[model samples]
Target chain A: MDTTQLLKGVLDLAVLAVVADEDGYGYDVVRRLRAAGIEEVGDASVYGTLRRLYSSGALTSYVVPSDEGPHRKYYGINAQGRAMLGAQRKDWDEFAGTMARLLGTEGGA
Target chain B: MSIVDDAIAQDVRTYAAQVRAALADLGPEHVDDLTDGLEANLADALADDRRAHRGTLADEFGAPADYAAELRAAAGLAPGSGGQRTGGAVDRALRQLVGSVRDIEGTTLARLRATRWFPGVEDLLVALRPAWWVLRGWALAHLLLQMVGAEQGAFWLPSSSGGWVLLLLAVVASAQWGRGEWRTGPRWGRVLRFASGVLALAAAILLLTLPQAHRDDVARAQGWGDRPVEDGVVVAGERAFNLFVYDADGRPVEGAQVFDQAGRPVTTEPYGGDRWRQQEYWPDGAGDPLFHVGVPGPNGETRWNVFPLHSVPGWAWADSGAPLDVTDEDVRGEVLAPSWPFAAAAAVVPWRTGPEATLPAPAGASTPGATPSAEAVPPSDAPPATDGSAVPEPEPAVP
Candidate 1:
């Protein structure tokens, strides 16, 4: 599969995973996504998705002003987001195991 | 400024307005920080986009309203689409009305600033002290002109003009004064002074043009007259035509047209009646409803209507009869019958009669038509001319 499509499939999972550890603002989330090897995620798209997820009760947000630049609006995963992330991780692992079994290869797992 | 910077600023303002609108239910206090934060982020993103040579920040991020809607949705606010009728309609109407009024006022003020007399007045007032002195002097000169029949024996006082001149002078003086004593007054004083200067300029134009507007009324009352010719042919060369008509006061009259030697209606369509007043000229093919008139020019053959008076010596009235081949000299012999109203309406039109009997003396004996200087005496006591008859008496010495 193309890397873009692969990245799109995993974006929500990646975002939930990042905020699961620590809250982050729009650009900060973009930086974390890049550091985690998902370079295709746009800044605005991340911010927009973060907002959408928060509105859906998957995440919560609070604003903190920065001395170096404009204030940061940080988002953290709530109980709902964590539960969704855990379910998605389990589904991905099971799917990988099934593909490995069908391919009959050690690397496919 | 760079186009990107301008676009960014515009986007920021638009985003701010949308966010504020969406957050109306949340109250200003709750939304102010959020909107500010969003704007700051948007600005930074746009700057980054510019640095990266991206086409438009808008394309990268969706429209500001969309972004605001997303934010509002996240905040658990009602979607924007559902609240179209409640307060939004009223706000939109009010904004539209205000925007239209502002557009008209701004256009009018801009046209006023572009005129020559405004700058001349500014330069005159700047060299003078007690700025009121310059204003009072113009007022007095106008009063004296009104008292005399000099301006066609008609009172020509535009109070708005004097008010504007005084205003401009004060603003200029205040700026100068503030520069010397900046520590005393607040910074807002300078802004007020700048605004005052702009208003003064607008007022000056209103004053000058308003008076001339009266003259236009008088000219219109003298309705244009036409001379019936059995047959007239306009040649390829220049020709002059004259006619006597009564001015219909200031009311606009239908303009006349000219015909070719063959009587193939050469004049362009008549304009300047109730339907439309002013028409713009465009050199390119962009002109709307192109108007064409027959006139011989340097380029073999071309059509032009409303040639400047200086270029074309006389005016042409539309002729309905057959075209007769006539030279400029031949056309000179034709006598124009004056409209009966032109001869009889003298009683009603002030210019038709002699200067009004109550003419006033020149303020402080300055020669009439000399263009009053800044030092001229402030003729405060002279009462403003009320009626058309109270023309100020022209100084006998005015050359």
Candidate 2:
């Protein structure tokens, strides 16, 4: 199955989780999500998710000046983001267990 | 930094600009909010790609347009159309029309930008946008001036100081509008943008046709040189076809040349009002030779200044252009004579035929020759000739 199609349903939750674990800039978050096995997640989608979270007050951003090339904008998850992530996590776990049981792989994995 | 790094930065900036352009229909502030850190994000992504030994960003993600769409969707913004579909039929139709126009415009711009030189040209155009704004304002001012029927002065410039003030205000307003300083709601902003487009088109058309209008005015002004005062003599507010001269005896004088106060020959040649009659006079002739043909002068030039210029009736001339001898005996066609006002004007000085009957040195510059044979001389008691055949006593001796 294409993970990209699956990633769209939980991109917001994934971005929030990644940011809560460790506050990071745009590319850093994208790299972290890829390393966590969501390799098909696009850069633009992650960046857009971060912006949306910031706009909705679930995340806060600050500018970090860099000596490399340009200034980097860093985003950190807030309490609202963490609470939303907790709720989505519970729902995902329940949904995954129901699917696993239906497929008769409940005890195999 | 190395030149390679500079090239990468430039590529990233170009890509970011393309993304922003895809979302341009959104308000400038909204677009800014969406694409604020776009360049830095793209640069970071490119650096990561280089370290990981991946292909270009385009290969990894997608085209800029698709990226912008994904961004817009993920950010909880509307699609590129941006119009909500919760309206009535008319609103839907209007939105459809606007969307179609936007689609065509975007497609055409994209095609143009794909050309080799178009990006540089677009850069130049973007740099010249302020100048265009000022010109748009000037055009709007001229349009208003024309609408109010107070159009004056030069074509590209306003006429008066007040006009200049209006132009200045319009330009400032236009520049402010271009810079997004005068903010409006979405609907009103769209309406104003459409109105400005129409006004700009009208101004371009006006500017293109200005030279033709100016030419017409110049032609009309120059036409004043040849006027009625010089064309045909008007007497008592009526067009006088022929001028008759009389001697001291109150007898009709033949072949008397007339001139104005300035020694210009006074002729009735130009008053051929009926083109059909002129065609009858000289059917296939090119020039107005018949117009100036009357009695011969000393210099042998066809002078029209001869008084009471004799003319054979139009039908008297054959197809060969020669006047046929049409006397009272052989009147084949109708001999329509000119409308003569009087048979003989009362002479100012009475005739003293015995000795000192000195003639006023012939009126015009052309020297008078021997008297012409009187084919249709007006009698003393003759009434004003209305139509055909004024000569009651036609000389059979005339050939």
* Top of the candidates by DockQ: 2
Looking at model 1, how many pairs of residues clash?
A: 24
How do all models score by TM-score? 0.29, 0.40
How does candidate 1 fare on TM-score?
0.29
Fnat of candidates, each listed: 0.10, 0.42
List clashing residue pairs in candidate 2.
Answer: none
| Candidate 1 error regions (>4 Å) | A1-9, A66-70, A99-109, B1-11, B15-36, B46-51, B62-399
Residue lDDT tens for model 2, B189-230: 667788789878977887788888888767777778644454
Q: Report the Cα lDDT for residue B22, model 1.
A: 60
Q: For model 2, what is the C-alpha lDDT against the true structure?
A: 0.65
Candidate 1 lDDT tens digits, B1-399: 689767777877676676567666544433542453566666666655323535555565556556655565433455432233343667557645644564465345334434767545644544453454444444445444445434542244435555445445555555554334443222254355555465456457546775687787666655443334322224454222221122345221112223343324333223321113212233234323211122322233332221210111122222432221122334323312111111222323536444434333445243222323332221112222223332322211010
Q: What 10-residue stretch in candidate 1 chain B is worst by lDDT?
A: B306-315
Native interface contact recovery, model 2: 0.42
